[model samples]
Target chain A: MSEAKTSANPLFLREEELRQGIELLFFAYRDFTSEADAMLAKHKFGRAHHRVIYFVGRHPRISVSDLLDILAITKQSLSRVLSQLVTDGFIIQHRGPRDGRQRLLELTEKGVEMERQLTEAQRRRFARAYREAGAEAVEGFRKVMLGIVDDPARERFAQSRRDGGRDGGRERDQ
Target chain B: MSEAKTSANPLFLREEELRQGIELLFFAYRDFTSEADAMLAKHKFGRAHHRVIYFVGRHPRISVSDLLDILAITKQSLSRVLSQLVTDGFIIQHRGPRDGRQRLLELTEKGVEMERQLTEAQRRRFARAYREAGAEAVEGFRKVMLGIVDDPARERFAQSRRDGGRDGGRERDQ
Candidate 1:
């Protein structure tokens, strides 16, 4: 770890900075999810539910396997949360058109409303941060975070970005 | 939400950018904790256990209430995780010097070793991201993340940075 410091590299490889980075991620992520958590609690939903709603809202007609791959949770675990969403009328499942056996998930109208509310709270924070940090800082922030994502998933993330806002979920991997 | 767009301010206020920010956080945080979660599972522990060990490691002699406040978890929820840590000899609670009734928590030698291993994994990822993104980007990343943290905690975070790398947990709020 100290090797980077010993070399003539312009970068300062201080352990202190590394630790601060870790703490920033911890506190920032905690505060980021907090508001959504409070609102989810009112509906008796957990963070897991929020993830499902957000993803389904982003990529409509997302297959169960794809969601499992994205969330990286067991089918058994997802079954309980997904079932609750379906029963509560926030999520609906449709049989894949090309493959009848596959179950593709989408948010109901109510689910869209819920997703909008939760997302609005988060966007407010991000918007404020972006406005304060300036465009250059926002770009730097995105570059650093994008660098942190796992290699394989980076492409999928970029694809989602290109797909743009709520309505465009065209990249069906069914 | 589009009100910001129609404003005379120079900020772009694009919804696409805001959505990308949300996804970046989700993917980045998920990948950030993946290594720790795997390591914790080997010991039959979870993220909650990791948080207990992390805070106790960072703030040696941290009081119970302070830990509870930082974690924002109920006393009941914290009790289960704390008991497991103590039982496993990862953390030891000492009587506060000024107030014997108050329990101050710190990591045992075994706990320190575990915390080091966990933190090293995270540090490596952060270091790589920092190096790739350059110093300016690193500063920008920190600025934006700091902006996201709630106001009160931000002061404590900065104080911890000034204290420089662990061992200075002297600000007792008992």
Candidate 2:
């Protein structure tokens, strides 16, 4: 069957090729995280810690609820990571100017430096991949990723995309 | 200074872009695994179990040592997942034809069915992404992923790529 028909119909799902994609996702993700995980491990942190530092560093002064929405995890999950970051002085949390219930998060100087190191390694990988793939492929990869996001998450993702534009996608790159 | 330089020099990485890549990795990966994780959770199995099942199913008659190599985990790690699969009748393990020390693995009928369901969700996601991204982007994504793979794992990935040629990259989907 034609590729278009096969994809559109869903009934003609090529089982074997799809499985390879699954494996690819597995292997690719394993490799993708290994570098950052090693760095976090050295710092006595875990992937959870990395996620918190990452998002907070991305949108400086972002509120707790906004972070919870972006990360799509329970407050408890975010609380554990956030508390650790705050205690360790990597992140500073303060009451929002307008909403006391909302905690605004920003990375400390040390936190910024550490986040840089962790992110730099990942950037090297992506930069290489993007360069090797070229602009067309990079755009394609982004679109594919956007398509794969779940519906609800997509809304949050879109909001981030809009906010990201104001920053010229700078926060996204971080 | 320019995009070209940033793209070309791995060491001269863009902090913002790199951070964005990290978030992309985090978000993309979470979305990527959610489908299978949900299915596995329903079965009281985690991702670890799915990995064991997937590799064994992919390489029928694969040996214990070979599996460890592919999984890049300790035998102890594989043991827990592998034993559960074997005990549950999802996989059948037999003494190697020539080497008694080596255990060869294959999926039972039930295992095959489970594998199908587990992979179908992922395949649908990938198929949609691939079609939306088009063939060029798909190729670039694969190339970028291949680049991210470390040296030791690269060989195994290459071997799989070759093996995949027979089914036109459908082995994993199956």
User: In model 2, what lDDT does residue B129 have?
Assistant: 82
The docking category that best describes candidate 2 is: acceptable
State the lDDT at A83 in candidate 1: 99
The number of the candidate with the highest DockQ is 1
lDDT of 1 by residue, B56-104 (tens): 9878888899889878889999999999999999999999889988889
Classified by CAPRI criteria, candidate 1 counts as: acceptable
lDDT per residue as tens, model 2, B49-118: 8888877777777778877877889999889998999899999988866667777889999999998888
Clashes of each: 0, 18
Instruction: Give the residue spans of candidate 1 off by over 4 A.
Output: A1-13, A159-174, B1-13, B159-170
Q: Chain A alone, TM-score for each of the models?
A: 0.86, 0.81
Total clashes, candidate 1? 0
Which tens-of-lDDT digit does each residue in A1-174 have in candidate 2?
234433444443355455655666667778888888998999899988988887787778887777787888899988888898899999998886776676789999999998888877778888787777776766666666666667655554454432242233222221
- Compared with the true structure, what per-residue lDDT tens digits does model 1 show for residues A1-174? 345434333344367788788888888888999999999999999989999999998778889988888788899999999999999999999999999989889999999999999888899999899889998998889878978888855666554444344444334565
Q: lDDT scores for all predictions?
A: 0.83, 0.72
True contacts kept of 1: 0.69
